[model samples]
Structure formats: C-alpha cells, structure tokens
Target: MRNRSHIHQLFEALAPKTEQKEKMLQNILVQSRNEKIRHRGFAPVKRLRSAVLAAVLMAGLTTTAFAAAYMGLDEAFLKFLNPVNHEQAQYLSNGAYVVDKQVTNENGTLTIKQVIGDSNLTYILMDFSAPEGTVLDAARYRFLDNDITTRQNFQSVGFKALDDGNRSDNKISLVMSVMTRNSIAGQKVHLRLKDLQAADPLPGIFETIIPGTWETEFKLDFKDYSTLYPVNQNITMYGYEAVLKSISVSPISITLKVDSSYLEEINEAAGELKEIGDNKHLDNFPITINYADGTSETTAIFSGLYLSEHISEQILMIKTFENVINDKEIASIVFFDKEIPIQTGR
Candidate 1:
C-alpha cells in the first residue's frame, strides 16, 4: 500500500477549496478502511457518497472478470474466457474448480459454480437456479471473516441470462470479489446473501420481493501467485501523451495503472473538478492486456478517479481482472492501436 501521508500531500496540493479537501480526505479513508485508523468530522451525505463511490470503484476494479464485452455462458470449463479476447467471463459453465457446496431455500439453489483468487482478491462464480420464470433483479452478499469473526468489504458484479425474447429467467450468473489484499488460503470463508428482489411481470409495478437469507462456506488453495512492475512507457491517445505506470496480475484479479500527461494541463487551470469524470479525458479508452500465452482481456477503469494537479502524478486509471493472468507472463499491452511490450524492469 502507498503511504497515506504521500496521498494527503497530493490531495493538499490539488484541492483548492477547504470543503473539497475535506471530502477527498474522507474518500481516501473510506476506501482504505482496512487500515487501522479513526476518521473524524465528516458530513453524513458526504460519508454516504464516499462509501457508495468506494463500492463502485472497487466493483469497477473487478470488471476484468465481468464486463459487457466478455459476457457469455457454456464453455470448456478451463478454457480462457473469450479465447480470442481471453478477458472477462472466462469460467462460465466449466466445473473444473467446482466446490459443489450450495444452499437451497425458497428463493432457489445458490450453488458455488467456480472460485479463483490470490492474496489481494477473491473472485467467485455462483449459479442461482430458481423456479422457471423467476427473475432475480438484484442481490447482496458478503464473506464472514472468522479470524476477526466479522464482515469485510468487497466488490461484485452479476449477469442474469435473458431469454430469447430478452426477458429475464430463473438461472442467473454472478461474480463477486472479496477485496482483501491478504492470502485467504486454507481459510473457511462464510458467505451470505439477503434481500433479493425479482423483477415484476407488470410493467410499471415494483419488483417481486423475495425475503430470505442464503448462507454457505467455502475456501480456496492459492497454488500460484505472482506480481510484476512493468517498465514505465510512453503512449499517445486522444492527441495527448500518457504513461503506463504499472501492472498487477493474479488468478483472482489483474490491475493496470495509467497516468495521462494531458490531464495535467487541464488540472493546472485551477478549475473546479466535480469528480474524475468531469475531465472526460480518459473516458472510453479501449485498454486491453495481453498475456504471454497470446491472450488478452479488455479492462474497465475504476470509477473513483484519483485527483492530481499534475496529470502524470494523478493515478489516471486503475484496471483490474478476475481471470487469472501471470504478470511475469504478460507479453504486451494494446491501447488505442499502440502495442506496448511489457519490459520486465530488469
């Protein structure tokens, strides 16, 4: 983890207003709650906003596993997800790593379909088989940490397989991440879900409410894990220069950090920055990661933006993956038609 003081210094330099500075500080604290520190004096709305943004950012961090581009079902279990893109939604129906542990209640049978992870994160694929015509519109889940015997924060995403008419169905697929930067090997994790709401048949009515709780426990053995710091390289996009700062890859997650030089000019203007999106500089950049195995996956940028007076200093983009990729095995990165080879900083 980076030094909080260093982060605070960067915040102090860029934030012009006292309120903005306070809000930024609150966001940092909210995202880094795993750190043992007490925060004081924050408006309730601001706190709630920061917490929601943290979940969103964390969820975005897991898009490398589940995204619009790599959504599909039925595959040869261990086959790399998109084979061509080899990016998101890799473990669709393959049961190579199936735990077979599940819970069945009135809602449905919540079965653990697949599991993958490392110290930094845990990615889970669950299959929900309900009565026919069932529509699981939304859900919530968490892992019970026994060492602490408490709950921890995580990021998640889900896809409900629609019918031929594009209508909802009983079988739904979900992928979730427990964003703990520590190894969960040989540890029993208690998982739970509640307050599931289903889509209503009537057009303008509320969703069909399902009131019940589903719980189960499972674990993963970390057979392999590795990390690499790629040589900082230069690239151009949207008529502006940027730097590919670093890359972190694992079975559960992969992360890419990009810094844009052009954004610095905009930030230096001392203008108001409603949020990272206000700049609209790094939006819709088709960023893809290529592994040594000749496979690549498109990544989603973390929604919560890192603010900076200098574009190069600002953590412009953070992309994460749920599919396993060895960082040391990374071959190249494809961004905006530019193929940047990963140079092991030897």
Candidate 2:
C-alpha cells in the first residue's frame, strides 16, 4: 500500500470507464505483489482501455506497495536484469570482491556493491537509491577517469543500468563492464563519476534536477580462475565456412570467439547485405550455448559482431554467463539445434 494513492490516481487519470478501470486496477494489484509485475492469469483489456493505460503503465505506473522483490542485491539484480547469464551471478556470490559501501550526498546515495576482475574485463555492479520519483537515464550518465592519460592497458568501457522494471520509482541498479587489452590485476584505478543528473520532471507540472559527483579507487585481484577450452575447428553454416577459435570461461563471463574471414566471405557473396529491417548489424544466424547439465540459453542479447578492418578480422563474440561453471562442461555450440563440434587438433 506504499503508493496506493498514486496508483489510484494513475487509473483515475486514464480515460477508461470507471467500472472497467476499477476491474483492471483490481487485477493488476492481485497479480503484482511487492512491486513485481508479471502478465500472468490476467485477462487482456479491450484495445480502447489498453490504449488509455499504455502510456501510464510504461511511465512507471504500478499497482502499489513494495514487495520483497528487491530485498537483497542478488534478488534486486535478478528482478531487473534476467537476460544476464547466471554465471555472472554465481561469481558475484563466490569470488568477486564486494564492498557494500555507500556514499551519500545532497542528491542521494550511491553504493558499490560488487566487482569482478579478470584478464579481459573488469565488471562493477552498483545501486543508486534516491528520492522518490527520480529518473536516472543510464544513457545520459557518464563515467570519467582523469588519470586515464597516465594509465596503461585499460581502454573501452560500457554500462547497462536497469530500473527494476519500473517497480520501484526510487531505486536504480547499474552494471558496468570495462574491457582492457591486458590484465587490470594489481592496478589501483581511480574512477570518477561526472555529470550524474537525476531528474524528477512532470510534463506541464514541475521539474527538478539534482547533480552530484562520486569517486572511488579499487584494485583488481589477480588470479587464474578461468578455464580456456582450445577449440580450433572449422564448421559450415548457411553456405559459409567458419572457424571456432576458442571458448574462454571465467568468473566474469563466457566468451566465444569466431574468426571473421568466413563472415566477410559470406557477406561479400550475399551482395552488400544491407541491414535487415530493424535488425541492424546483427547476423540472422542463431547461436546457442549448450551445457552438459542439459540447460541452454539462446538470445542475441549475449552476442555481438566485431569487424576489424585493419586486421581484416571479423570476430563473432558471444557473451555468455559472467562466471564459470565448474560442474557443467560446454557440450557444443548449436546453430538451429545443429551441433558444431569443438575440434581439438591435438
């Protein structure tokens, strides 16, 4: 009943009939507990009613109350980011360096929850809890390191922030990955967060902006905790021949690297393969990861195509579980359920 008033107001503001609106509200409340909403066992509303409520629901509209959804760090992360592989979550629970410390300012509080470091990537997970009705658009948030000019090896950085599915209007979680040419182990890296702007704006109402700065220094723990499976094999798919370079399983991620020459050949033969409508820069081929435990995950969210013009290398990088699974050996890479053997020419 935390946001009972706001929830009721949201429905009242919609143009649906009073009776239909009440019924929808009742259903949403019954389905969503603790701010976690799932479309299950709920009847679809009429198109007209849905149209009236669509924008509001997308704008963080909810059925009220804070459920046990985001009670803990792991639970909170899972609630918002399910597309992330389970290995990363397992590593956070096992080997990652975690300091559940928080920094507070007039704007709000920021916490660095956990971190995973390896030879190839440095991953950091953090949470920001601010005043109610806050909007921290991850696209606008920036990361700054003033001493980067003095550092070595570390290069590009990327981040993904999720707002617990609009379940809670006050808290947001972020996962940031920094890729380096070499290991970041034993190096004290100073990271500066600049221009973190939190906005609470109501169109045609009132607007507010809170700006703040946060800084932190941490060192990567160096250890050989990953298993590198040597797989230099050639496989044919969709009239194209390619080589599976290797699969690297670490506490932070599962990376599958494929040579690019084959892709280039296929692309050239296909005749300037223009971006498929709305599916830009992605190969239509389906790639899946199968584990010995009989579990598999399929999605383009964990995959990327890297084309290096200088080296004429087109490496297909499939990003899987962030952590390594010791009990489950990778069975094979499957394309459309067809197994591609991991040939070791030993």
Candidate 3:
C-alpha cells in the first residue's frame, strides 16, 4: 500500500509543476512579444493584436500540455495509492471495494468507527450508551441499495443490534447488515425507523437534523471480483457503525411485484420486450416481466412513489387475469405504482 503521506506529497508535486509551467509560459510570451516589437518595429496596433493572438494560442497549447501531465500524474498516484498488486488495475476499475466512516450513540454514550471491505461483504461494530436503568428495547438500522441495477443479483442482511450489559462497560453493540449483488438488474432498498426517544432531546434533534436522513445509492457490478477470486465464487462484503438518537417512520417504502403474462409473451416472441405502455398518470414506471417456467411468468412493477400515498389517487393499477392453460389456472398481471423514499444509515 502506498503511504498516505506519499499520496499527499505526490499531490503537492502536481501543484508546483503546474504553476511552474504556467510561469514559464507567461515569461516566454512576454519575451516573444518584446522581441517582435523590437525587431520588426511593427505598428503599435498590429503588434498588440499579434501579441494577443499569440498569447491565446500559447494558452491553448499550455492547457493541452497541462491536461496530459495531470492525467499522467493522476494515474501514477492511483497506482501508488492502491495497496493491491499493480497488475490488478482492472479490479480497481470495476466497483469492488470502498471505505467509509460512521458514528453511533445509544442512550447517552457515543462511539464512532470506520468500515472497509471488498465487493462480497463487510461489517462494522458500534458501541453506545443506554439510558440509565432503561432496559433494552427493539432496534433496527436502515440503508438504501441504489446500485442494484449494476449487479446480477443483490441480497442485504439487516443490522443485528446486541446489548452486552454483563461487562462493567455499559454499551450497546450493532452489527451492520451485509449486502450482496449478483446480477445487472439494478434495484434500490429504503430504510425506515420507528419508536425513538432521548433525555437530551436538543442534541439528539441537532444530530438528526445535521446528519438527517439521507439516501445512499450504490452501483452493483462484479467485474472487479475476477482479480481476487474465482468468477463463480466472487463475493465482497463491508461493514459500518452509526449512532442512534431516535427512530421514526420515514416516508419511504419499496414494493416489488412479479407479473406472469409479460414473461410469457416475451418467451413466445423469443426476444426481450422492447415496447411498454406509457402510463402518463403513473409517472412513467418501468415494468419488467421474466419467465421462470413454461406455465408461469414473473412480472415486476417498480414505482417512483409509494402505493399508499397515491393508491387512492388512482394514479397506478395492477390487473391480474387467470386462464386455463393445460388444465391449470395460470395467472398474469400488469403492475404500477408511485415512487417512495429509501432509508439510509440509521
């Protein structure tokens, strides 16, 4: 691994080199114009115009040179900063690993930590205080999975919060969930919180507002795994920890539905469905239907809004039809809905 200090030095080198080049160009332009005026005795107006044009051209050349140099420096710095083998450039290009920091508070105590991992999975542990004499209650953490589209398939395990009251140290432990992706169909998962309180409501309120509830979207792709593991067994995991002041219902929910007929039609056609209905009132939701077997199809409906918020508005609808095929009542349906907020980092 390249030392952090070395990276800083490299970055510093970039600035001085860039400045020196700019200074040299400026000096060159000044000397060139002075020589032109002295040797040619060109008219003041003509000389001035020539100088300006020359300066513009020089500036353009300088910009191009600077860009090339900067790119070279960037690549070099990345190579040095990467701890893994330099030969693994392809792995770095793909979304394989990431690092992050988190803070958490329980009751009144607080703790913070860092999270890092490869693509398969990782975990973060959080320890926080509990209200005096306040017994442990239920706890949960939420996050958004926006990168589902890039991966083949993605699965996320919820954070497991544990209370260890036996030790002299009073602390609540939190184990961040694991998220895995295996496919390209992108999807996002929202987090929701409920039931929270604090003795010092002001600080809690400030933290809530400062950090607030935010959504994190991730692009899922596994091309990076080939560098470290067998293609079929590549999995990356990471972990994080955060404090909790309070929990409340967030205005976000995700609904996944599968339809059967859409898949059937596609299979019959022997191609991907290219055209879909444009439901203007439904906020242009995208539908995907897949066939799992000959007799049944899975139709998935994704809405930009929550069904609860707009179901009464008649903004979207799903209609199912049943037909007797081979003495079986096969079911198929069309699905639609509005979007909803996704929770992140509780």
Candidate 4:
C-alpha cells in the first residue's frame, strides 16, 4: 500500500504526475480557475436546497473526453446551467463518471446522465420526459419521491431542475445532491424515483402522470480527481477555540468541516443565521484559496449563507466553483489567518 503522509498525501494521485504528466495537468489547469470560489455556507445539520450549479469550460481545455460528451454533462452545463464559465470543465470532463442508465414507462422516460461529487456533496444529473402526446409541467408534474438512498447514514438533500433540458415540451433536466458526515468517495448510490405525477385540480393532491416507477443506481468515482485534505488544526473563532477539521476540493464544489464541539452559544448564533439568512454573526473568519499565480479567490460572493447545527460537531458547508480547478493550481488554502499549503505531489 502507498504510504499516507501528512503535510503531503492530500496532493497524491488526483492526477499523479511525472514531468510529462505534470505538463498535461498544467495544460488543463493553466486554462482554468479565474472565476469566483462558491456560494452556500454552513447550514443546519442537513437541510436540502434546490439550487443550480452553473459552471463550464473554456475553448483551450477541451479534451477527447469532452469531445465525446459521453452523457450530456457538457451539454447540461453549456445549455442547462444558468451561466457558464471556464472553471472545472476540463477536470470534470476527465473525472465526472457517466451512468447513462435509463428506465422507461408508458407516461415518460428517465435517464441517469452523470454524477460528480464526494462525501459532503454529491450531484447527479438526470433527464426526464413525458410521453409522446403530452408535455411535462414543472408546476404540475414531478417525481413524488425522487430521492437517493445511502447506507452510510447520509442525509437526503432535495433537488431542483437544472434547466429545461432539451428545451422540449415533454422533457426537463434534474440534479439531485445529498450530504453525509462520512467519506462517500467511491460509494455507490441507489437513485429511485417513484410515482410520477402532476398536481390535481384540488389544492393538496396529485394525479399520476407516469404509472410505473423509474430507478437507476451508480457509483461516485471522484476520489481520483478530487482529494480530501485533513487539517486537524485548531483556530480561534469569535475568540473561542474551534477545530479546522478537514477540507475536500473538487472541480464542481468545495466542502469544509469545522468542528466546534458542544458549544451552545454557537448554536444560538446559528439559529439567528438560519432565520435571517445573512453573514452577520460568526462570519468573521474567511476562507480563501490561493493559486499558483500571486492572485487568490476568497469566499465573498456566495450562493447562500447557512449557519447551522452547532449542536453536532459538524458544520455542513458546501459550495461550487465558477470554473473547474486542479490541485496543481492551488498553492495553499487560507482559513481564518492560518495557511495550509498544498504540495504539487511532484
């Protein structure tokens, strides 16, 4: 077995490099990471939000994998996601695993396109369509129980439509993401959507759009492209002691776990954050990712700020990048005022 060394190993594999291999990765990274860091902040134990991840690639970083566009993930980002950028597309193209699993019923069809994620955040993109004659109504038709099943006590996070996939009347694209305390890198997830339906004329009811259920399962193999780094260091938060546990970065999103064990005062502040949805209390400490160049990206403009779950040792914070990123481009991660350097694994 390869040795797992601290102050180092996190940079291991994730695109292992020789002089030539490093050149290939540099070709990819040189073309990425100009966009902002991400949105979404520390939230309640496991509250799900229906949000879209809008990021893509540039012209130079295109690879054969991207050319293939195996399961439309490329298309999904280009057309479906709101705004596209040059971050992470190349890295994702080489990493995002493809499923292409499809299940059809009389009413419509469902196809599992692709997935890219780790333990904290896992995103699965899928396509759904109504049958020939009719079209799908977003307000009307939906999977009554479109959910991911995880054996490792993972929390089920809700999903939302990435966009009008295919831009067809009968079709819509969906992205389902979930959260967990454990490392789910290399874990298989069973995705099952049961009872497709539309809202009934009655206010609180539903009618069947598709008679049967649609289910597909796949494994997340993102560990090779995205690596989780353990910090195990303590930091001063609000003049209190808190542990900066671990951080894992991927092309699509960033997840960091900060541990403030058994702090009721922190919980009180978290309650206010959940209620107002802003960065006021306990937002003093900032996170920034430095690149190979002198410039760096900070957590300024986020998608959402959720301060939550101080009771548990976990502060579930997950965010996505505007572009794809690589470990080679990152020099160090700055949390609070402490700096954790990332070795190039050369």
Candidate 5:
C-alpha cells in the first residue's frame, strides 16, 4: 500500500489502541528478522498475533445497499461500487452460489462463503475471523499466498473490499473478495492460504500482521455464466484501425480481445504515429454495452490487464461495469460510435 497523504491523516485520527498496535507490529517484525539472523538454521519461525482490518478502505464508510443478511456476489461488489440497474443486479444475485466449506485454526476461521464466475474471471467471497482478536482487514491483512493454485497453472489474485461494519477488533463482519484471472469456472480450484500477514501498507498507515497457518485445501464450485462469441467488428480507436477480435461475457465481467500491432520492432523511421494506435491507447477505448431493454451502460476499463500467452500478437482489454451484466439480455456492444448487434449463440 503506497502511502497517500490522506491515509496518513486517517491513521493519526485512529484510536490510541490501534496506533500502539501498529508500532508494536513494526517492532515485532524487526525483532523477527533479528531472531532469524541469530539462529543457525532448521527452525520454524514463531508466528505473531493478527489484527482485524475493520475499515473498508475502498468505500471509506459509504454503505452500499445490501438487501440480504448474507451478501451474494453482487452484494459484495455493490458494497464498494456503484449500484447496477435492477435487472442486471437481479442476474448477479441469481448466479451467486454458496460454498459453505470452511477451515478453522488458533487464529480464527476462514470460510469460503460463495463463488461466482465467468469465462475470464472468478469472484470469491471469503470471511476470516479470529476469537483472540480481529486479524483480517483490507487496511492490513492478506493471505501470504499471492496466487491461487489451479490444476492448469497459478492464477493471479486481487482483493476487492473488506467489510467495514463488523464488531470485533478485526472486521468481525470482514468480507473480502479474491478475484482470479483463470477461466476455471465450474472446475475445482485448490487454495492454500499458508497464513495471513500484513498487506502492502500505505506507508505509516500501520504495520503488524496476524500470523498463523490456515493450511486448508478446498474446492471452488460455482456457476459458470460466461458465453463467448467471435466479434469481427472493426474498431477505430485512437485512430488505430483494427478488428475487434472477440468477446467473452459473464455476469461478473466482459473481456475483449484485440490484435496487437506492437509486435513490430521499433522502426524509428516509421514515425511515432504507428505505435500510438496499439495497446498504448486501449485504456482510452470507450465501449458501451447496450441491452435489449433499451438500457445501456458504459464500461470502466480495468486498470490492469491479464497475462497473455501470445503477448506480442494480441492484447486482452478487460472491462467491468459498475453493476453486473447478463449476456442474454445484451442486444449489442457499442464500440465508440459503432454498434455491433449481439446474436446470442451465434
């Protein structure tokens, strides 16, 4: 967590107990490092106490409309993002499937509450609780493991929001989403949460990690809401004329594949104009999803991109909606001014 100026101010205003805990954590990490140097070898490091991150950093206290006691995939996202239209919201709600499986240890319990997916993304709701103290929070705690191991390969993962309104020192109501890149929907996903530790801290925000191995192996079973269709639609983005490769739609997100023109070696004589049209300007692509009902929504292109097998030949531009979207209800996708009609199953 890079320290933004505002985050430091917020920490200064935190409770004294929280302040002390942060200092204590920094000192403890230093102490741990020293201990490691002193020891010869062949010894397991002792773990430290974990803290609950009650503050949902993304929403900053904005409460989303969560209609149910248990949040579905849509509710989890809505808690920290813009509200979707009624119909799209309903589709998201129906697609969410429960995965009540959980694992408990001395630190607390880590439960896999629910999971939902599309062809390119997986959204998982996880709850971590500690009886001794709150140990999981977006502000500070995260799984030691970086990627979710799949039978095929290791998939990159990211955190969405931490539940803000829980009672425990940690978010007693802590809810976190682990989004993965692999298209492993409807298949089993092997998760090894070695331990929870201090997340990338917003410098001076706080330090101190909850330590304990919740070495639990579980399977992720969820509904696959993705549909793939070839889209030969021509696009003129940033003046780069190229065919829109294809699209994969699911309730969670939409992915667009575009041909990469950057593969050519830098030709200084060709002028800078050639490179300008490539993926360099994809972030500026204005795409809209128009539904059959006459409603349309603009996409918020995701900041980061997934790894591509053929990186030199093509680029994958990921787009997400403020609210969830259903594929069947989609009538066409508008790329800039051109509207490409979507014929389901075609």
Candidate 6:
C-alpha cells in the first residue's frame, strides 16, 4: 500500500497543472480576440479622417489661386491708365492752330493766309500770337453769327506722268449758309452749291473719280454757345478754301487757306451723345463736307447711314484721343452703326 501511494504521487507531479493554470490561459486567449476586433473597428475611422483632411486642404489652395489672379488683372489695368511720358500731349497741342486775339481776328478778316502741308487741304490758323499781359476771354475762336453769301471752291490737280501728257484737274463748289446768333426757330436754312463732276480723263492713264453729292447740316446749340462764348463777347469766324497744286500718286501736296470769317466747327456731337447715354439717338448728327475746291459745307443728315459711318467715326476718334491723353491703350476701339458700348470710369 505504501508503494502504491508513492506511484500515485509521481503520476500527479508528471501530470499538467489544473484549475489556476486553466483560468490564466483562458484570460490570455480572450484578451487577444478583443485586441483584434478593436484594430478592425478603428481602420475605417482612420481612412475617413484622412479623406476629410485632404478635401479641406484642396479647397484652401483653390481660393488662394483665384485671389492671386484677380490682383494681377487689377495691376495690369492701372499701368495702361498712367503712361510714363508726355510726348503725345505735346504733339496734339503743337499741331493745333489757335485764333486767340482781337488784332489777329481783324487781320484775318482783311486777308486770309494759306497753311502748307502734305495735302492741299485748307485750315484756318488762328493768330493766337497776342502781346503779353493781354486778357483775352476764351483763347479760341468759334463760328458765330455772320453774313457771308459766297460759294467756296475746292480743286484737286493730279499728274499722270513726270512732265508728260497725263494731267487733269477736279473741281467742286460748296455754298455757305449764313450763321446767326439770333434764334431762327421754325425756319430752316439751306446751303446750295454747284454739282460735283468728275475730272477730265488724263491721256494714256486710267481716270480715278470720287462720286456722291456733298452736303452737310448746321444747327445752333444754345448751351454750347453760352458756355463757349458768353453774352456780349465779340468772336471772329473764318472761311476755309483749299487748292491742290502738283499732285502725284505718291506724296500728294496741297495748299489750304481760310477766309477771314470762317472757322472749322469742332465736333460737339460727341458731348451731346454722352449726355444722353444709352438712350441717345443719332438722327440729326452734323457733318462737314470737304469739296474738290478749297471750300467745305456743314450739313445735317438725319438718316441711319450718317450715324453708322460719319458720326461713328467721329465718336471713335474722340474716344481714342481721350484714352491716349490719359495714357491708356484700348486694344481696339470699334464703332458700329448700332449703339456704342457703355463707357465707365476713366
């Protein structure tokens, strides 16, 4: 029986430990399963967080780029408005002729002088050469009330060859209508001139001819008269006459002069257009017609054609002149027969 007990004790020592050891092993297995489930649940949350962060970063970058582009555009516009030099201003001023004094006005009335340039086109050069310390009101002369009924003539002489038989002259006459400061309401004045005819054919050369009847209309602007010439102020008007001397195909030359009582009417239609804005209409726009002779006629054509061609050109020229004066360059100033584009801040 003692030997049996000893064998039983040896078997117990060799056998695995039970109860407490079993409990520890079960606890370790449950912890490993819980850790694997927690890692699987957190994987989707980490991916979602990364995606949201990336989206926000992209939005911020896009906004920053747009702001930079806007700033660059503004800077470019400003540079065009302010030119760095003043050469253009001087050119326009020097080219213009001003009639500013009373004595020169009297001399112009007595005898007109011719202005020489590329074309025999005539322009009145106002004798603005006044003595120092003279206080002349309004240093420019505009057409005022005048009584002159003479038909002015313009002639263009062309040469077909150098000292050969190819020579011809074209002549046209335009009548002048009397201008008056006194209001002539309901009474229309008509300016009549000789019909324009083509020049005689030149021997051994093709004849070039310009067609269509030349006429223009004139109207009195009370506001412009009041602003430019105040009440009881004496101003002189001059008449223009042109004569084309030796005219070759290349480098044509002409001589022009103004009679004592005539002056080239400045285009005041542009001012009227601006005052009316988008609702403006161009039915009665004014035009100055240049004839083959040394004379021009002012008339008004209340048709759509005049608005599309002549008046439109005048508007574009004025706009371009203003932009250039302000040191700005518009890509291309186009004037259609229809309504002009709206103009904003200078």
Using TM-score as the measure, the top candidate is 4
> Is 5 or 6 the stronger prediction by TM-score?
5
- lDDT per residue for candidate 4 within 100-207, as digits (tens), equals 788887767888887766556666778787777676654444567866777666465645565453444878777766655555667777877887666633253667
lDDT of each: 0.49, 0.51, 0.32, 0.58, 0.55, 0.25
lDDT string for model 3 (1-346, tens) is: 3455554554554344777889998997897778666767557867686789789879988986644422332332232223223222222323222222233334244332322223333233334454566443333322222122223243444444443434334344554434332222223323222223222222223112111222234322222121121111111111111111111111111123222223333233333334444322222224322222333333233222212112221111121112101111112212222212222221
Candidate 6 per-residue lDDT, tens place, 145-240, comes to 222222323222111111111122211111111212221322222322222222322222222222222222322111110101112212222212
How far is 314's C-alpha from truth in model 5 (Å)?
2.2
Candidate structures ordered by lDDT, highest first: 4, 5, 2, 1, 3, 6
How are the candidates ranked when ordered by TM-score, highest leading?
4, 5, 2, 1, 3, 6
1-346: candidate 5 lDDT, tens digit per residue: 2223333333333213776879987986786577557653634432211111234423433443222212344333445332234444445555666676688877678777776666666767777776764545445556656445665443456554455555345543333444344477556656667556554445423243656665444555555677777887766555555567788776557777766464232122223422333223233455788887888877443333444344456656566554455567788887754677776531
Better of 4 and 5 by lDDT: 4
Q: Estimate each model's TM-score.
A: 0.44, 0.52, 0.25, 0.61, 0.60, 0.18
Could you give candidate 2's per-residue lDDT for residues 1-346 as a string of tens digits? 1233433333333223789979998988774452333433444644444565666676544432111111222444333223223443333334445456577777777787766555556666777777666755433233332222215543656655654566436677777666654456556667666444432322222223455676667655434335566677776645777766666555345555666556666556545434544324334555676666677765454333233342645453434343233323556667532465432211
In model 1, pairs of residues that clash are 77-94, 81-90, 146-149, 254-321, 264-311
Stretches of candidate 6 off by over 4 Å are: 1-84, 89-141, 145-328, 334-346
Residue 19 of candidate 6: its Cα lDDT?
78
lDDT of 1 by residue, 105-194 (tens): 976777776655544455456666776676544332222221221243433333222222222565655555445423454566777776
Give the Å error, residue 97, model 4. Answer: 2.0
